[model samples]
Target chain A: MRALLVVGGHELRSRLRDGTAPLIALVAPIMLATLFGLALGGDDDPPLKATIGVVDLDGGEFPASVQREALNTDELKGVLTFRQYPDEAAARGAVDGGEAGAALVFPAGFSEGVGAGRGGQVSVMESPESPLAGVVARSMVDRISALVEARTLAVRASLEAGVPADRVQVFVEENGAAGPALSLVGDPVAGGRVDLAVHYGAGMAVMFAFFVVGTTARSLLTERQNGTLDRMRAAPVPLWTALVGKSAVGFGLALVSMCATWLSSVLIFGASWGDPLGVFPLLLAHVFAATAIVMLVASRAKTDAQADGYTLGVAFVFAFLGGSIVPVYNLPEWLRGVSLITPNGWVSAGLSELAGTGAGPSAVLGPIAVVTGIGVVAGALALLGFRKGRFA
Target chain B: MTPALVCEGLVKRYGDKTVVDRVGFHIDEGEAYGLLGPNGAGKTTTISMLVGLLRPDEGSVRVGGIDVDEDPVAAKRLIGYVPQEIALYPELTARENLRYFGRLYGLPRRELTSRIGEVLDLVGLAGRGDDKVDTYSGGMKRRTNIAVALLHRPRLLILDEPTVGVDPQSRVAILDRVEALVGDGMSLLYTSHYMEEVERVCTRVGIIDRGRVVADGTKRELVAELGGTDRVELTLDGDVTAAADKLRVVEGVSEAVVTGSSSIRLLVAGGRHLLPALLAAVGDAGAVTGVEVVEPDLEAAFLHLTGSTLRD
Candidate 1:
């Protein structure tokens, strides 16, 4: 145990003493996070806003309740900003010219059809790129449909009792506005500010943590090529101990780096990482898994140069596939399934769950188990190969 | 008495090339043995195999009577190896490097500290021990490297090209320190391509070429076997081959060869004594311009046996 500590201390001091090593390991990740945060605006949740143009070409007046019900609706009031469009061409032009995100068109026969007890449908045009445009277009169509359906139902009731359709429609339109008020249920994901910055920060942490493994593996190769490893073997200590000592140091540094990333997210970007106790241990476990992977790679490399090339190629590929560089949901199902094999994917998934709503202890258990297991297996493989001839 | 290090018929192959052929040698306790060879002559390979860094294809290595193959840890405990390259971490201080290597040798904390200090003093770097190894001169780094090997105070020390690229002053200091260690009853197996260094510091020298020992003995004995004397050469304008044949009939000349188109070289018991007859021989054949007598040293003996210059 003491020997391991001494060896680890030496490794740590060596890393800290080097100028570029610490800068890349510690400072680079944080800087990247801040840059991405300012650019993307926090999390994946977007706050959408749009200006919608409305055109009513109907000449005949509709029932007072129809207009009052349409204007006083709760669903459309908070979601969209309405502007009156004088004609269909004008509304369409407004949508195309970027003056409005979407256009609502009520045809000339819309009021007459509702007044005669026959309901009509409205058409909404929207831009392809705007989330707000989609939302506004759908809401306007649904609200107009609901208003027409109520008048139709009232006329049908009167006709069943042998009353005239015109008289029934006229009578129902007057009372339509008196129907029960529209109310929406409470929002489940409300007040959870969707900041793109948090996602960027989490992604950066996982990528950098994996990078540390690659860097350490390269260092291991260097030690071997330079004869330091052989000199160490000449000592009385078992070679396995030396290998384990190096992996432990790598694990510790990775864990610290992970913590610094999370802290920066909190202190600089205003990210609320939920509970600290849960995240810290999970991060440490994930770091252990990363360390094992590093050892496995370092053991296979015959020289420092080989290790550098192989580690960089492998680490970045795994990182990108696992959603460190891109989100998993945006990828195809097959690609998402492929990410399951990667520890970094599991780590990012685990971090998102910890900070996401509806997360529990079970959410973190899978990543912890996967990463820890990989670490154990990788550590053993490295140790075994190390004893054979890798270090020699 | 058991030898400190012994290898019987050691064979190592890298791919199709046999690097260390069935070579057998031993260094008795407290004896200084040198493995002499030119570049790429497999001297490093032999030392690596003995140090347990490379396993021999077919050989047994016993360090302090412990088989390296069967019990490497036990054998390694008795062996300290300083490789051709300086292995200490450059960013670490000299003292830190020593302490790290000491811990690797499983020295107890108390013993590790004391031994680190002792070895530092022994290598003549006690005052600069606290300075980073990278800041030290090439010689200081070499001294620190040797100190690493000495920390465990093992029974056998194997050094491979220890002073290959160092300055002359550092080379001399390193040789002096190595001599001092061997005199204090430590067995040493030193490998170098420098023939003079072998002649100066080694008690016994083994000349290895093409993965095999071509000759092995004390300097004087090997020189004597190759004929103990100087060589005289005469450059003549005419009939050099017939002049070479006539020189062989001389009383003191042991061997004669037409080394060049116009030159005849003769190995004689006494070059000065044979010079008169060689000049007379050149006169009997043709006009002679230059007649020179040079002493035969290890360099000459190596050239005679290998049919190649020592530098090449």
Candidate 2:
């Protein structure tokens, strides 16, 4: 154990003095996260307001009411601004010219159809350039149409039941201004909000964690080539102790890089990592797994160039599969399934759950267990490689 | 007293080929034993097994009476290995590297510090201990490598070509330092292809070739085993064959041969003692123009045993 500490401390101190490894492990990840966060608009800045054109051709109380409600709805107030157009041609022109994201046109006699217990018709025009705004505008038009349909059903039911006309008119007038007939309540999505900034932050951290693999493998190969490893073996220290010490250096650097990225995401970008207790263990397990993988590569590699190529290839493949460069949610289902097979995938999934949904410690247990298991298996393989004299 | 290191019938093989076959030797306390071999002569391989870095296929290595294969950690504790390559971390200071290896040997902090200072001074790098190893000259790096091995003060110091690339002056310094250590009662198992180095430092020599020790003994013993004869070349102005015949009858001359029309070579038991009679014999045959005597050394001994030069 003392041998392990001494060797490990020496390895770490040497790396720290070298400076290149730490720069890649820490600064590179943070830089990637910042770039991705900026691109994704994951910060707390307000969203852009979309301009929507309203064309009321019905010249009736119902059309005017629909327009007023769509424009004045609390949910759409800051998000969607409206412009009243004189005609369909004007509204459509505004949408086509990109002056408005979308246009809503109420056809002539649309209010009369509802008054007579018949369905009303409305047309929505949206530009392809502003898809988000167009979708929002269409949903608002749908809500107004739903209200019209509900009123028509109520009026038809009253007449069929032989209610007095005067009472029916009073009912229509009273209910028309109330609200939409079907009020939709939202439930949380299984994975929660896919915060782009946090996703990229965690992804970049995990991806760059693998970058240390190349350095770790190169260092191992160099020590072997330079005869330092042989010298160490000749010392009183056990071979396993030296191996453990070298692995600890990689693991320690990875752990620090991962934690620093997480903390920076939280402090700088306002990213919530949910439960610290849950996230910390997963990070440790991830570092362990990453370190084991690198050690295994180093043990098997014949030269520094071979180690570099192998490690970089593995890191990239794992990063891509694990959705580090792109969100797994955005990937195909089959691709996402493939991601789950990698430790990076498990780590990303665990971090996403913790950061996105405020998941508890229990939520990350399975991933942590799997990652730790990988570390154990890979570490064993690495030791076996060492025993086989592959590193020699 | 127990020998500092003993390897009995050490054998190592890779795949179907044998790299080291039944090579065995021992280093006694205060003895500087030189393992002289040409390149690819299994010197490093044998050393590796002895130092617990490699397991012998058919032998046992005991360092300070501890079996290396059975308890390598204990055996290793008794051995300080200086590998051919510079093993110290290039980015770390010489002092830091020594301190690190010292700690690995389980030395106390104060003791390790003092030992580092002592080794630095011993290697003549006391003032430059704080400089990073990479910044040092090649000779300095080599000294630091040796210093690291001495940090634990092991019973046996195994040096594998410790002066391979060093300048002549640095080589002399290293040899001087190694000799001083031996004088201080430290055992050494030194391997080198340089015959002069072996002759100057080693009390006992083992010449290995093709995974086997072809010759092993003290320098004088090995030389005597090779008939203990020195060569004398006498350049004459006339009748070389007649001069050779006269030299053959000299008191200490082992054999005499005529090589050219004007030169006669004599194999003498002792050239310096036999030279006067050899001169008279040469004068009896012809007028002597020049005389040259070659003494029997490790190089000649090695060539005699292996039928090859040490450099080859």
Candidate 3:
């Protein structure tokens, strides 16, 4: 144990002093996340945000309800910034003048007509310049229409079930003032909008982490080429102690890289990876998988140069296929299935899940098992390679 | 007395090929032994097995009476190994590298601190011990590696071609430092293809070839295996063939051949002394302009035994 610590401490200090390790491990991933984040969105806000105009003239409970829910919803804060107009003409003017991406106007008698089980009048004004915002507003209006119809049907059913007409009207006016369809309308993800940036931060992190922590394993071949490995082997300590010492450095650097990237994403780009308890297991598992894979790849190389080539090749291929540089969903359907085989894919999937709504510790249970399994299998294969006489 | 290191019938084989076959040697305490061989002659493999870096297919190695297989850590404690290349970490300073290895060697903390300084001074790198190894010259790197090997003060110092890629000045310094260590009662097992280095530093030399030790003895003893024959060359002004025929009849001349139009070569006993008599015999055939006689050395013995040069 003393020998292992001594060697590990030395390896850590040496790799830190080398300059490239720290740069690749700590800085590269954060920089990639920032650049990709900026390209996706104009800033750290959602990738697609636009201003929408709302004009209400209905003087009824249903139109008031739709106006309140659509204008000030926090879940849609990233995708929709709401503005108010005095009239439908003014709302059209805002859309035509490009002051707003889209607009909504509620006709008078909208609530009474709908409460009588008759249809209400509503209109969506859209602009060619901001089609996404227009689609988002239209989708919210459709959900509101559905909510009013469902409430009208319930009121009629209540009357038929012998509830007094006066009481039914009070119930309809009170509960119907605030619609429950806002969650589906406010959240772009639940409305079929994909946010690839959620995965980009941790995705780039794990990919670059492979290169950073992998160098320590590749140093085994470098040491062998330069004869330092033989010197250690000829010493009075167990040779495997040297390997353990190097691995401890890899694992430590990987941990630091992961935390720094996660923190950078949160602090810089406003990314929220939900519940630390849910994400911690995936972080540790990803680190182990990265280290074990590099060690296994390096052990199969005949020389240090060969080890470097193999490490880089594997890092890049996994990055592309696993949605680090490009989203896995952007690939062909068949390729998305292939992504399931990569460690980065599993890590990004877990991070994306945690970044979404209502995520708990159970969000990453599957990813944790898969990533940890990869580490165990790869670590065993590396040990077998060492046993086959690549120890020095 | 117990030798510092001993091994017999050491063999190492890869799948279908034996790289070292039944190679055996011993180095006594305070004595210097050289294992001389060309490249791929099994010296490194044999040394690896002896140092516990490799396991022998069919032999046992004991260092200071401790079997290496049974207790490798104990056996390795008695060996300071200097491989052919400088093995110190380039990113680390000389003192840092030494301290790391010294700690692994199980030296006490305070003792390791002091020993690192001593070894650096011994290798003449004390002034630059705090600089990163990559910033130093190649020779300085080699010296620092030597310092690392000597830090633990092992019973046997095994150096495998310590001067192969060294500058001329550092090569001389390394050889001098090694000789000084041996003079201070250190047992040494040095491997190299350089004949002069072995002839100068080692009392006994083992010549290995094609995975076998063809001969092992003192330099003179190996040279005497040639049966005291010497090579003689004579330069004649005229009639080289006739001169060769006349010299062939001389009392000590074993054989003579006309090598050139004006030169005749001879194999003879006591070549240095037989020069004058050969000149008298060649006098009738031609006027001898120059004469040369060659004596026996390790190179000649190697050529005689293995039929290949040291550089081969």
Candidate 4:
């Protein structure tokens, strides 16, 4: 343990002393988080900025009423601004020229036909190039069409039956009773701040853990090249003990870096981690797994350059597949399934669930088991890759 | 006295090339042994195999009575090594580096602290241990590297080109320190391509070429076995083909090799007897501007045994 600490201290000091390590490891992650967080938005998501224009060609008896109803709908109040143009050509031109992203056209007799128990087309025009705008335009049109029909139908039905406006309002209110309840797990954490912190903390730790492995592997290569391996071999310490000492240094350094990052997150950034007991097992499992992967990579690479490239490629791929950048929930189902096979994904998922909710600690168990299993498998491969009595 | 290190039939091969082929020797306690070789001669490879960094294809190594392959940890504990290249962490202070290497060998804290001071003084870097290694000169860095290796006070010390790139003064200082250590009874295996360095400091020398031991013994013994031949080169102002023929007939002269120009070199048993006759012969043909009689040394012995120039 003392030897391990000694090596760990050296590794830590080296990392702090290197200007590049701190920049990439700490500064980059924090900057990325802040930039991405702001870009995604704060609480109370406003409707995204999307340009929508309308060409109402319908000059009917109930046109004014239709316009008033369109203006009052939920979709139009804040989500969209409907601009009435003289013709579809002008609106289409505006959309095509990029002045607007989408255009809507209400055909002639559209409101009148709806009043007479008929329907008319509310054409949603979009530049196929802007697929997102097309989607937005279609959604807005659907809302407007529903609102116009509901108002027209209610007015026609009441006038034919000679019902007064006040009575009709009372009847509609009475019938619009309870709706279907939304189906989901349970109440989420009131604020997103805790979830965000745990997600980034676990992810950043996993990412930098790979760097620790890469750096240690490079140092091993350097030792071998410099003939120190042979020197050490002539010493009293066994080869296996030296290897253990080296690997333990990497493990301890990575652990300290992760712990410091965690502390910083909790104190400075207001990050709340999961249960301490739960976190340790999870982090321990991942650390070994990451170390094992690094060792295996180092063994395969004949040069420092090859090791560096391989570590980077594997680390990033695993981090991505593991859902470090985006939540597994937001990822495509196929990708989420892929993430389960990687230790990083399991760690992120396990940590987020454990730290985010007081009651959902059980949600972490599956990921924990998977991560530990990966560690075992990777550790076996790493040990196998390490040739015995070969350092000198 | 027991040998500080011994290896019998030590062999190591990489792929199709036998890098260190069936090489074996021993360094008695308190002896400074030098392994001299050219590039690709497996000097470094042999040292690495002995130190337990590489597994040999065949044979065994014993350092201070410990079997390296059978029990590497025990074997390693009894040895200290300094590599050809600088391997200390530049960002760390010399003291920190010494402490690190000491702790790596699992030295006790108090012992390590004291030994750090002693080794620093031994390498002549006593008060400069607090400075970062990068801040030190090349010679200073080399000294610290040696200090790191000496932290454990191993019975056998191995240095691979410890003075490869340092200034002449630094090289002398290093040689002096190495001699002092050997005098104090530590066995050493020093490898270098510098013939004079091996000739000056090594009690016994092994000349390795093409991954095999070509020659081994004391300097005078090997030189004697290779035969007492001196090289006498004579530079004349004009063509000396006729003069070379006349010098080759001298009693002590074995053969005379004439250059394409007005110079000739004679391989003779003793230059003291052959020099006057050879110089008179060169003077007979043309004006003799330069005459030199060089005795047998490691370089001459190397050329005779390997049939190639040592510099080549």
Q: In model 2, which runs have C-alpha deviations exceeding 4 angstroms?
A: A43-192, A390-392, B228-295
Q: Sort candidate 1 into its docking category.
A: acceptable
Task: Tally clashes: model 1.
Answer: 5
Q: Give candidate 4 misplaced runs (Cα > 4 Å).
A: A19-31, A38-202, A218-235, A240-243, A256-280, A301-307, A328-337, A348-363, A384-392, B232-291
Encode model 1's per-residue lDDT on A1-392: one tens digit a residue: 76667667766676677653466567887888778877764533332345677787774454233334444655445444667788989988888887787877778887777656687767888865444554545554665577567766776776787877657655665766333233323321121222456667777777777677666676667778778877876666655555666666666667777778778888887885555665776677777877777777777878888877777776788778887776664456699888878887787677666675436666688788887887789878877776565473
lDDT of 4 at A217: 76
**Residues A352-387, candidate 2, lDDT per residue (tens digit)?**
778766779999999999999998998898888878
- For every model in order, the fraction of real contacts preserved is 0.68, 0.87, 0.87, 0.72
The weakest ten consecutive residues by lDDT in model 3 chain A span A185-194
- Interface RMSD of each candidate, angstroms, one decimal: 1.7, 1.3, 1.1, 2.7
- Winner of 1 and 2 under lDDT: 2
- Each candidate's lDDT (Cα)? 0.74, 0.80, 0.80, 0.72
* By TM-score: ranked, best first: 3, 2, 1, 4
lDDT of 1 by residue, B155-242 (tens): 9998888887789999999999999999899999988877778778888878888889888777777787766567677788999888
lDDT of 2 by residue, B1-312 (tens): 999988899989999999998998888988999999889999999988888888788989988889987888888998899999898888789998888778888999988888889999999999999998999988899999999899888889999999988888899899999999999999999998788888888899998999999888999998887575776778888787777777778888765666577876666777878777788877767999898888887766776677555665
Kindly provide the TM-score of model 1 when superposed on the true structure, using C-alpha atoms.
0.72
Give the deviation of candidate 1 from the true structure as CA RMSD. Answer: 8.3
